[model samples]
Target chain A: MIQLEKIEKTYTAGTVQTPVLKGISFSIHAGEYVAIMGASGTGKSTLMHILGCLDKPTGGRYRLDDIDMVNLDDEALSHLRNGKIGFVFQQFHLLDRATALRNVMLPLIYAKEYPADAHQRAEKALTAVGLAERMSYKPNQLSGGQQQRVAIARALITDPAILLADEPTGNLDSKSGTEVMAIFQRLHRDGRTIILVTHDRNVADHARRVIVLKDGQVAEDRLVAQPRDAESELAAVVDEEVRP
Target chain B: MRTLRIAQEGARALAAHKLRTFFMMAGTIVGIAALTVIMAVGKGTEKKVMKRVNAFGTHAIMITAGGGKGFSPPQAGITTLRLEDAEAIRSQVQGIDVVAPFAVRRDSSTKAGSNQLQTIVMAVGADWHDAWEWYTTDGEPITAEDNSTMARVCLLGTLSASDLFGSQNAIGEDIQIGNVRFKVKGILEPRGTSPMGDEFDRRIVIPLTTGMRRVFNQDYITNIRVTVKDSRQIESIAKEIRQLLHERHHITPPRDDDFAIFSAADIAKMARGISGTLTYLLIALAGLSLLVGGIVLMNILLISVGERTKEIGLRRALGATQGDVFHQFLVESLSVTILGMVAGSVLGWVVSITLARLTQSPVVISWESFALAIGFALVVGVFFGVQPARRAAKLRPVDALR
Candidate 1:
């Protein structure tokens, strides 16, 4: 579960104070697939940062799993992020020198008690993302779709409560984007809490709920009548390719 | 355990970029190598100096005939230095211990049975044994009766005895030195080599009375060997002897005297020669290289921190503390220097051994030098590593991830 009450974030520069997120409040229960939708400069990235515990809100109270994150120091926040939040970036920020398996195992290295079966856990996570045969492949050697999948595997390895993805399909081809969306749908169906942040309506259509932001404030919050099924969309794209 | 794992990550990064790691290590290697070599040569030079000082007698002063600035052997055919001057030093000097007047003749023809050779022959008093602290190892020493009676007896140096007798017992044997058949009364103790690089055990010795009355036919001696009661007082006593000789010989300023005095201190100085300056120069080089090397290492580490900003951000987001990042960088630096120290010590040993073989000078390889090298490596490693580590640790994850 997550809660944000009137979160306000202001950027200070010399003589000017620019308001990014002004008095925005929202809440999402466990196992909910939600999409936070906003265009550039609409403060979606700022909200994502605050949600991931990477940055503190200037004035507000944010709670995750019944604990207030706003009062925690940087070190405590880092530990909280490692244990509770799994992040997938638009760039698929995997270490270029590390293999997919190593990239997946990176989060566990920072855990307070290192798991003795870390290698096995990384392997299992990579296999769950359909990268069983490409465990040793580096990011540069993997396809854009496969690299994003590896990032997904890395995010899931820590078994965090929330999977926060910021434009997960931003850099992928349509077919590859469909495959990633399909993976997210499968994860959502398995009762994982997923928050998809993106500027595109098509990406938001894959989630069960959409919260649209306009001018640093929430403009719409509605449940989808019938969400787009990414698995079926991916099959239709494959069918189209085979027919051509 | 966490620190160790983080340090291993640092090591892994260094291993991944081996060329950069080697570049970082170069300065430490050269600096430590120079330091090791300087220590080796310095210790070796000190050992040589001690040996020469011991050989020249720590408390003894030699007033050689004929004037010279450097420590040289007594000049041949100098008639001004006499037995009376030795007596004057024995009676007048305050800390006088022993005063032995002696003469030396080089290239004297000596023969035993059918063997013949030309060598130095010395004419010394009974106190020569105490003054030189060199006594006969095999037979009776030259006594006062031998000088008073003008006895036709001599002492054979170990090498001279071996050269003439050839494995035969040389004591009590007859040896002819320039038409005088003298009985070998003793075999002197073996002295390895002189400070002048001559064989000390290759000379022959006879009484002063016989040498002056029968063999050399001269009343003037060539050198006065004076030993003081205390070695610390040797230099002052030597100065006093020089003054007495100046007054007795009626010599003043601007007029060169007929004798030159050398003490144990002078011998040590001559033995050390330019090595002291050479040691200082090498130490400076060692220090400069280490300083320059540490700076270069720091700059490279700073650049590496800049280059790996994304990696650092990723790690931070993955839950690494600021202390973790700092520790990793420090570990990288320490590993470079410690590894370089090992390589440099081996290199220094090879160079030192090669130098010793080529120059035939002593090169002492000591564990103290290795320990000191380790100490220097740690200092350079930690000193240069901290700033870059601090810089890396100061980066905000939000800013770095951008």
Candidate 2:
């Protein structure tokens, strides 16, 4: 669960005051699938960073699972980022020199309660992402889709409370994007809370709720009674590929 | 467990830039190696000096020409030491045994048949062997008749005999010394070396009268060698001889001695003192080299930190603490220096061994060299690594991610 009360973020560079996010307030319950959509410079990414605990709001109250995140120190914040929340980015920032298995095991290396069966857990995470056979391959050796899958596997390895994806399909082709969406859909069905940030309307359609940002504030929040089914859509696309 | 993981990560990061890592370590290697060599050579010099003094024996004392309690400084004038002064010390000094007065002049050309070589000529009394306790291995010692007649009969040191005659018999053979013909009486046995690294067996010897009257034509002797009856009385004998010489030269207060007397222990202490200064100079040089190496390592690590900004952000996102990243960089530098330390030690050992063989001094490696090499590596690792590590630790994940 997450809570925000009038979250605001301002940046000042050499006496030039710039506001990135202004008086934004929202909350997401357990197992909820929410999407935040905005155009370029709409502060959607900044909002996502605040939500994911990667950055703090300058003027706001932020609570994650009944803990006051606003008062938590940097070490506590890092621990929350490491275990309570998992992040996926468009860049899929896997270390190029590390193998996919090592990348998947990355979060465990920093975990306060490191699991004893780390290798098995990493292998299982990779398999869940359909990358078990390519676990030993480095980021440079894998394709863009495969690297993104490895990054997803790394995010999943920690089994965090919430999954936050920022423009997850921004850099992918349609088919790979469809596959990724299918995986996310499956994760949501398995009762994982999800927060997706995107500028694409099509990507937003997959979520149960959509929140749109205009300028530096939230413009709309609407519940989708019947969300698009990503698994069925992926299957239809594959069928079309075979027929073509 | 976290520390081990961090070290592994550091090693993996270093493996990414193999050439860069190796070049950084090369700087430390040269520094440690230079330190090792200086220590070994310095220790070896001290040992050589101490050994020479011990070999020279404490019962013998030496008197040079100038250094006495007089208006003249030591060894400044044409030479005041005379055969009469030596005889006077032999008679007046109670502990005195054999007083063999001697003088040395260098750059005299000796010719035997067609073989010619420049050699030092030593003028000695007949009691030279008795004072030195060094004897002729072949024929006989210089006689009183030879000194009184100023005879042309002479003895040769082992090396000089070999140089002049090769494998031929030197005894009873004729050799030309400064255009004067002399017959070789005997070949003296080998006497190893002086504390100053000069070989003692390379000089040509002649009777004191023959050397001073015919060759040099000087009435005064340059120095006198006095052998005491007991080693315990050697120092006291030196003092008594000094007093008699000062009184005879009319030396009093407020005047520097025209001569200086050094017992065997004094010679050894002087040698140790000289080598001690050399050791300090070499350590300073080693410290300079380590500083240079540390600077180079710091700059390279700074460049590495700059290049790895994205990686740092990613690690922070993955739950790495600021302390974790700092430890990683510090460990990386320590690893490089440790690698260099091992290699530099081996290099230094090999070089010192070669030097010992060339100089004929014992190969000595002090424990301080090892401690210094290891200590420098650790200090440099921390000193150079901290700045870059702190810079990396201070990077904001949000800004870095951008």
Instruction: Please write out the lDDT profile of model 1 over residues B10-100, one tens digit for every residue.
Output: 9988988999999999999999999999999999999999999888899989999999797777777889998889888888889989999
TM-score for predicted model 1 compared with the true structure: 0.96
What does candidate 2's lDDT look like per residue over A66-167, in tens digits? 888888877788888898888888989999889999999998888887789999999999999899789899999998888888988888889988899989
Q: In model 2, what lDDT does residue B246 have?
A: 91
Model 2: per-residue Cα lDDT over B132-197, one tens digit each: 887899987788889999999888999999999999999999999997899999888788875556
CAPRI quality band, candidate 2: medium
lDDT of each: 0.92, 0.85
Clashes of 1: 0
What is candidate 2's DockQ?
Answer: 0.52
| Tens digits of lDDT, candidate 1, A40-98 | 99999999989998889999899999999999998898898888888898889898888
| CAPRI docking class of candidate 1 | medium
Report how far off residue A186 is in candidate 1 (Å). Answer: 2.5
Off by over 4 Å in 1: none
